[model samples]
Target: MSEVPQARRTCRRCVLPESPPDITMDSEGLCSVCLEAQSSKPQPEEELLESDFTRLLGKHRGKQKHDCLVMCSGGKDSTASLYYMRKRYHLNPLAFTFDHGFETEGALRNVHKAVEKLDVDFLFYRSTFMRDMFAKIVTSGSGAILCHLCSMWYMQVALDIAARYDIPLVIAGWTKGQSAHQGTPSNGAGQAGNREYASMSEATRRFLATLKQDPKYRDFPQSMEEVLKRARRRHKAIVLSPHWFLDTHPDEYVELIRRELDWEYPDLSYPAKSTNCSLNFLAMHLSLKHYGYTHYHVEQSKLIRANQQTREEALKDLEFNCPREFLASLAGRLGIELPE
Candidate 1:
C-alpha cells in the first residue's frame, strides 16, 4: 500500500478557509466544530419555550398604538415571529418585505404562508435601481466594510412603509445572533433609537455632509426634512427571534413549522430563492477569499455563541469560498473584469 497525501481540511459544504479561530481537527479530517454540531443535546420543552416567548411578545405588543411594521424575510425565525405576534402577543402588525432582487423560492413560499396564517396586510417593495446600485456597491469595495448599506436599504424600505402608514413600531426578526457585535438590547435596530439620540443625530448630519465627497453617494443623503420626520417617528424596531426564543433544534423547528403551518416545501434546485440578488452570494465568496472570512463568519458566530448552533455547525454553514464562476458572472453583470 502506498501512503496517500492528506487532503486539505475544508468544510464539507461551503468553502471556509483553513485558517479560522478555535478551529479543531478530527481524526476523520472534519473540524471539531462540525462534529459536535452533528451530535445533539437536550433542550427546553417546546411548550414552555413558547410560553416564555409569548410573554416577551406581550411586552412589546400594543394594539391601541399604531400598528407595527414587521420586516419579514420568509425565513424560519422571521416566520415564527409572525405567529408569536399574532397568536401570542395579539398585535395588529403589517408584514413588510424588501424585494432585494434576490429571494429564493423557498423564502417566497414561507412569506406567503406566514401572511396567510396571520391574515394581516403584506407589502413587497421593489427598488428599480437596486440591481445597478448593488452591483456598484459590491464592486466598489466600499461595500465590504460598509455592509450596513445593504442593511440600510432593507430597513429604509420598511421605514418608508411605516412612515406612510403611521406605523410607530418597526418590528424585525433580529436577535442576539444578528447584532451580537454591538452588546446591548438596542442591537436589533442598530443605533436608530438609544438615549444617545443627540449624538446619533449629530453623527447622521456629519455623515450625510461627508457623502458629498463620494460622487457615487453624493446625492444619496436623506434630506434634513426626512431626518426630522424619521426622528419624530421614534421608530421602535423590535428584535424577534422565534427559533432562539423557542429553544427548539434546527431540524425540529423547521419540521414543527412545516407540520403546524401545513406549509408545502417548494421544489427548487437552487435551495428555494431565485431572485435578482445573485450578487449577495457573489459578495460572500469574494469576502471569504480576500478576508479569509465570509459574511456568515461574523453573522453566524453570534448564533453559535447564542447556542442556536454549535460552533462546528456554524463553521460548516459559514464556509463558502469565492467560486470563480460566481465571481466572473458578477463581474460581467457589473460590466467589469477581474483585475489583472
Candidate 2:
C-alpha cells in the first residue's frame, strides 16, 4: 500500500490520516484526535504487573475442565497469547476459533498447529451465517460497519461457549490499545467506552436497530452495552489478555511464537504482519470511507500515545493496500459488486 492515501493528509504527530469532519489536520500538522488528547487532563493511571495477572489466574485455576477459553485468531498477538496461556501461565485452556467463511487458510493453519503443539482442547466453529448480513451491507449500501457488527456477534459466541462450558475466564489477545480496561478489573464493557469510538459506536448502534427489525436478527442487541449487560447476568467470565499485563514488546513475542510453535505469517494481509480475516479489507474500506479511520488506526493511535509503538512503526504497519480488483473479488463472495 502507499505510505498514505494521496487524497488524505496524515497527522505529523501521529499516524491517523485525515478525513474531514471526523479527523482533520490543523496548520501545525496535528490531527484533531491528538489535540483532544493533549487538551484532556491526565487521569490517574493504573500500573499492571505480571504478578497481578498470576494472582488473577490463580483465582479459578484447576476449578473446571478448562481453566479458561482462549480466543485464538492465529495472529501474532493471539497465537502468542495461546502459547503463554498453556506454557507460561501453566493454565489448561480450551482453544476457541470461530470462522465466518472469510478467514484465511494460513490463519486457520496457525490455529491448528498451535493447539496441537500446546495440547489444548480445540474447538473450531465455521459457518456461513454472517454472509447474508455482510451481503446486505455491501449490496444495500448500508452505513453499518462490518467489523462492529461482527464484533458483537463474535463476542456473543465467546460468551455463549464460555457459559456453556462453565469456564471462568475468557482470554483474548488484545493489547492496551484494544482495551481501555486492560490491567484494571472491568465489568466487561470494552472499546465502546473509549472516546475515540464515540462517533463510530453511534453508527454501529443505529445499524443494530435496523438489524433488529429483521426476523432473522430481531433478538439482536441494540449496542455493545446491551450485549454486555445481557451477558453479565448469565455468565461471570472475566475477559483478559496476557499482553495487557506483560510489557514485553510485541516483536519479542512474535519471535518467540515463531521459534517455539512453528508459526508463519500469512501470505496476504492488509496492515503488515496481521493475519485477520480477508473480509476485513472490505470492513476497513467502509470504515475509512465513512468514519475517516478503521479500528486499527484507533488502536495504533492509542499505542503511539502510550509509547508502546512509535508513530513511524504505526504508519508502516497500518499502511492500507486493498486494491479495487481484490476488493471486488472479496465482495463477489457475498454475491455483491464492489462499492463504486
RMSD of 2: 3.3
Model 1 scores a C-alpha lDDT of 0.52
Worst ten in a row by lDDT for model 1: 268-277
Q: Quick one: best lDDT, which candidate?
A: 2
Best by TM-score: 2
Cα lDDT, all candidates? 0.52, 0.80
Candidate 2: regions farther than 4 A off: 1-6, 180-195
TM-score, per-candidate, Cα-based = 0.62, 0.91
Q: Candidate 2: minimum summed lDDT over ten consecutive residues — where?
A: 179-188
What lDDT score goes with residue 96 in model 1? 83
For every candidate in turn, the CA RMSD to the true structure comes to 9.0, 3.3
